[model samples]
Target: EDYRAKGFFKEALVNFVALLGWNAGDDREFYYLNELAEKFELERVNKAGAVFDIEKLNWLNAEHLRAKDPADLIEPLKAELNSAGIDFSGRSDEYLKSVIIAMRERVSFVKEYIEKSPYFFLPVAQYDETSKLKNWKPETGPQMLRLKEEFAKLGENPSKEEYEVALKLVATELNIGAGKLIHPLRLAVSGMPAGPGVYDILVILGKEETINRIEKAVSIL
Candidate 1:
């Protein structure tokens, strides 16, 4: 932020990508780095930052993440984690897909998963119990149990509005504010205090995966 606060834009731009994700390889350096020598276009570089408007970046990152085969991103994601002594051993790419979906909101550069997210993605890693405790609650536990049953019935590609409607229903049944269901629900899915609206995450993850994560959350709680 300091270089950015100064007018060293090129340096700052180099630093900005470093702020969130990992560079996959030296083969491609155009988007935010070294490409200036041949491919740098002023139109491409913004003098001002978007300031982590995760909604915009989440959609963009998901587009990029989804466009690539799950295998491509998964191996890199696993390799990055393993180098740090994190584990993806024996965990299926299916779970990794859900982790990517869960974190799409919490990350900007997208590869932030390799660095910013270890607790949620890796196996048998130690984490801050206090942080996890911040979002888990007794009522939230039962709420998720019920949510699991509800979401378990959805099809492969349910819409966001479908999940929203289901959430509103869950809110009503629980006799609590949607904020209660949504906030805790989001925390449970992403293992973070904040993220994309919970409904959107559910929609992207599809129905079955959503239910599976909710079931996992209930068990953890």
Candidate 2:
């Protein structure tokens, strides 16, 4: 015998299980339990075996996760962060929600979302060496130093638009593609070659922290 077990939202589980051997006689694939109870009919159920599909289950889970209210999503996320020893004393509910909003589309499970996003809670301890070598050029140090200066002029917590404008202005003045600076700056802030948008990460990290990370990256180069 083969056995498998996992967790799911009650409503998603009910909705998923109800579909295994039944059809609603329409193309819709999602419904609330109450909606299912309202529409379910014994005559509509297929007599054939229904193989449980984990991929379909995960898709349903992602849909339900996206539909969740941010307030509803926050407490459990906080608990998971706490359990992982991530400090939340300085981070606000709004800040946490911003992270959840940014991440919800990219994750199927709450824990998976939290586990993959340590950069949200911790500073970039070290830059990725490969990215550093690839993106951090001889002239990149001066360009990043210029980025720090431009961002410092924005005071704390510049808007995303403001961050973009600053980086573009610097890139234009330096006569280089915005990507040249963008990739290295991402490595500076998150120590990764890739993740979220650079301006999104910069705005969330705030001006001082972003500038400081860039300075560190410049020193390393």
Using lDDT as the measure, the top candidate is: 2
**Candidate 2, 1-221: lDDT as tens digits:** 12112436666777788889998999887887778999999999999999999888888877888888977888878877887788889989998888888778877777765656667788777777899889988888998999888888995669999999999999999899999989999998888887678788887777888888888878876
Kindly report the root-mean-square deviation of model 2 from the true structure over all alpha carbons. 2.9
lDDT of every predicted structure (CA atoms): 0.59, 0.82
For residue 71, give model 1's deviation from the true position in Å: 13
Name the best candidate (by TM-score): 2
Tens-place lDDT per residue, model 1, 43-152, is: 45545544554343344344444444445556666755675676567567877776676665555443577556554554323324564576567777888788777666
TM-score for each prediction?
0.51, 0.88
Angstrom error at residue 127, model 2: 3.5
Estimate the overall C-alpha local distance difference test score of candidate 2: 0.82
